[model samples]
Target chain A: MYYRALGFQKDYAWASHDDIPFSPPKIPLSQATVALVTTAVVDASIPKPVREANSYPIVDVPDHFDTSELSWDKETTHTKDRESYFPINDLRARELRQEFKALAPRFHFVPTEYSQRHTIETDAPLITRHCLEDAVDLAILIPL
Target chain B: MTARTLEAAGIATVVIGSALDILRTAGTPRVIFNDLPLGNPVGKPFDRDMQHRTVSAAFELLFSAEAPGAVKTLPHQWSTQDAWRENFMAVRAEDAATLEALGRATQATRLENKAKGLFRR
Candidate 1:
């Protein structure tokens, strides 16, 4: 099912095709500071996007919703219609912190945001400013 | 700031993205290969072993990459996503509430879209 979606019919050689770019030099993982932020609509302050302009943002359970296995919930059924706000839900945050602890001990968790492919310069400086405060040397973003 | 801005500021950034097509079209420079899934690139949540492999592979590509357009895809038995659905069956009711809430919020949705229009950060 997954293979069909990526349209991977070009050439199996792509797997062996090792060609990438360089910027954050391949220094020892420690020498380089790292951060991880996922696009799961997770936010520490507000509820995971379950309200609408005319709705009360009710907190209800969805048909297939699950919450006990981990610290946060990635799938939310309360959202009005998959809004434009960053879906920084509790579940995503939990998973993010887990990855941070695993991959990069010093990895910082920057505030969540929407579409990494689109965030504006002025809008992100505020978030980046705090990341700088946290002593973050670099960022490792995972878009969900 | 974009990779260009970060480089200009002397703060180096490594964009481990799956959108190679978009990156190529836009002519984004100094990027690396990481065909990890869109959100969970390093494989499914809690899969530590795979995560390590993905991160290690990314570093290799980053270090050995020849030129700006240099690219590399990991040789591990990579597969498409969708396994998460079965795992998600164990989610709790409270967590379900959270997902529901996040799915609906209208104002927040608008705000997110607005941010997208501003920058592809």
Candidate 2:
């Protein structure tokens, strides 16, 4: 409704808020350990999140991941022998070149269709702990 | 989901995706809006060089951003037209009823999976 008031159509997802948390990075880019997080349902092996209530993880590189369930055209996703929606190879190449100090021990996968409540309460803490455990300093979120 | 939480826990993040409005509303600490296809956020599939640049630019935000919720627009061009509109139209042109049904079914599947404890290891 708020988005519609701003001339956006009914299809737009709009949320009104007053205050949210904000914290700047404490380290430089070259010294940081980067991690990849995506919501494109990387592999069918990943347990799907609950409707508006949860998130899950896909361990290791999904060599056989499928990307057809997402809204994107399959032609683009399947081109050039691509499998997973997460860019593991690209991130790895950057890491190998020392673009960053290191790569996180593991990557993460979270389904995009969920409520803010679930994200803030469950998904957030899980990801934070994982990042902290792996000593990751930066996270790259690739939403579908 | 994870972006804000990571930032709050002292880790920085850069959301590289097409939905600038959604990311801002979600309070993403750092955002790099890439006007690319939905599934191809990093770059066009198999284009390693472009993908590396996209990831590099995303990481650059860690130091360049002055405040929380800093959003920068990337200059890469992955799609020729409006990405979301294109996806929506692509599905609609196929079958309107099927698209609507599939949307509902996806939500239902989530609830089903949640009940099965599939959201955890």
Candidate 3:
């Protein structure tokens, strides 16, 4: 309900942390490898939890993973119905591919649920090693 | 996950988010981005230029040491706005119903009734 009231479900959703596709003029790119760390549910061991029955963010589920799921319309809010909520606004990342690949084409993107698991095994440091394994010089950590 | 730990790994990390102050207040203990929302940390899903701009903007934080715990909010990207399940709400409900029906066939609910009668004493 709050998400709808705040317009996040529809439009603001797409405005999440993602890799865009535009090529910048020139930013004097860094030689360091760039990595993306997110809170996306990725443990094959545990099945993804079911969405809360009444928790907000349900209204934004996309209709489909493909194009029928989105609308460029600006008048009314474009609510997603669940085509791929796991993306967490990753559609922006897909669209902005050129932008990210430009900075570091070999960038490594990894998702970890450390915030939820912060008290558990503490996977953050291990995740860091995975990024560094690829010689990650800079890492973009996006938390949910 | 990646932000604070990578920094702990001695790799400079720049964090971005619409809930920067919220995160810091909650004791995130590292850099903060006082910009984008929970879902849209970098920028909206489609605006490449803004997304690129947002991503690069965070990288700029590395050059600043004026504050060990720093935060920055970038230019707001507002597009003539408007628009928004749980992933398993309906499915779980269905699964529960299926199991309940099967139990009734096996008399699980009936078993509860018999137990209640036995304990009525």
Number of the predicted model whose DockQ against the real structure is largest: 2
Residue B39 alpha-carbon offset, candidate 2, angstroms: 1.2
Off by over 4 Å in 1: A1-29, A44-118, A131-135, B30-37, B66-70, B76-121
Q: Every model's Cα RMSD, please? A: 13.1, 5.3, 13.9
**Candidate 2 residue-wise lDDT, A107-126, digit = tens:** 77665543555666766687
TM-score for chain A, prediction 1: 0.33
Put down candidate 3 lDDT per residue, B59-111, tens digits, no spaces: 56655434445566676644433111122112344466564455355345445
Q: Write the per-residue lDDT of candidate 3 for residues A1-144, one digit (tens) a residue.
A: 322332223422211222211111122223444555444333333322221101112234333322221222222222132211223344335335543332222322233221244312345555555655555565555554
**Chain A vs. true chain A, TM-score per candidate?**
0.33, 0.67, 0.35
- Please report, as a residue range, the 10-residue window in candidate 3 chain B with the lowest summed lDDT: B82-91
lDDT-best of 2 and 3: 2
Predicted structure 3, TM vs. truth:
0.48
Interface RMSD of each: 11.4, 5.5, 13.7
**What is the model-wide C-alpha lDDT for candidate 3?**
0.42
Docking class of 1: incorrect
Q: Please provide, for model 1 over A43-75, each residue's C-alpha lDDT reduced to its tens digit, 9 standing for 90 to 100.
A: 333333221011111122122221222222244
The DockQ of each candidate is 0.13, 0.42, 0.12
Q: Estimate each model's TM-score.
A: 0.45, 0.75, 0.48
